[model samples]
Target: MKSLKLDYLKSLKWADYLFFALVEPRRLSGKIADAASKPLGGGIAIALCAVFSDILAASLLAVNTRFFYYKITYGFLLLSIIAFVKVLVTAGLIDMLCQFMGYPGAVRTMIVLILYSLFPQMFLLPLAYVFKVISFAPPFFYVLFSIALFVWSALIVITGISETHSVPFSKASLMFIFPYAFITLTGFLASLLALASVFGYFASI
Candidate 1:
């Protein structure tokens, strides 16, 4: 058990993977692939990091609030809702699929890859909107950056999936597709709830 535990520890590198997620994504891919055949916590750690990053970005973007405390509190609450919903739906649904296909623990690899694949988005919004890093830059530049981040995230996701499993590309793409479909379903449900609340409020009045 000690030897196995030590090997698991060797496969896990939450900090290093997070850092290289952007600069050295190919290197990050190797780390993820290495963990595929091992029972490691790297994926779980990275997923949690992504959640924290979302909350941070939301809080930072709330800078317009006159008071720092309320800004952070409300921002974290707002982003937490979205992040948890996405995370839960993605993990649950994908894990189910993986299990169906005889890749049960592949969820660990999936979550890490998904988080790092989305690192660009999670990293960029805070820098651009919150810190005002590229505030002086032209609007077109921001748009271009967003596009690049999205494309890069997509490419990295594909590579990560390919490395983690021997599953065909078509099956692997389902991992991406399911999360997006869940997001759309979630949004639709939210809108319906909002509409119902609005109507109920007017009826009560």
Candidate 2:
């Protein structure tokens, strides 16, 4: 047990550990790119699915309230479950991407990326709750979080594309936003179109 603990400490010092922690989305994107022959639609679908799933999971968990009301668990259970679902979906998405992109060891990479990316958002949740500022908190927080993940993912993909893909991090970050921007725009347009169609149908009725 002592040796195991020592080894664990030693492993923490490795650069790969830091790399995986700081830039996990890149690793995830690599996996996704590898998995799908055509990544754009599949990537968007996977992301949207994960986001909706997380929202649903959080909503259901929030409704339980037993621990919050009686046991006085202080948000531990809620935060824990939220983190678990986030990590699960993140890992699954990464694995699917890697498989699509034709990368080797997609499953292993997904596990590593998920483990590394797990805790940051958990930390964010309590901070947000404590601050109690939804106006300044929710919208930009998730947008920036998604952007950061996508930036890392894009960096990994670009780096993998060429030995000399040496764009600055800021530029790469902007590029990463492209997919998300498109997704947002398209989603908005689709919603508008759907609303129009519904209103038109009602008018005819």
Give the number of the best model, judged by lDDT.
Answer: 1
Question: What clash count goes with each model?
Answer: 0, 17
Question: What tens digits encode model 1's per-residue C-alpha lDDT throughout 56-119?
Answer: 5444444445665653577556655665566556756776766766774666565566666666
Residue lDDT tens for model 2, 1-205: 9997579557763334335434554544354334433223323333334344334334333545444343233344454456556545544554454445454434433433434343233333443343334445554555565456545544543333221123455543443344456557888999999999999999999
Candidate 2 wrong stretches, greater than 4 Å: 1-64, 67-118, 125-165
Best by TM-score: 1
- Model 2 TM-score, all chains together: 0.38
- How much is 182 displaced in model 2, in angstroms? 1.4
Give candidate 1's TM-score: 0.57
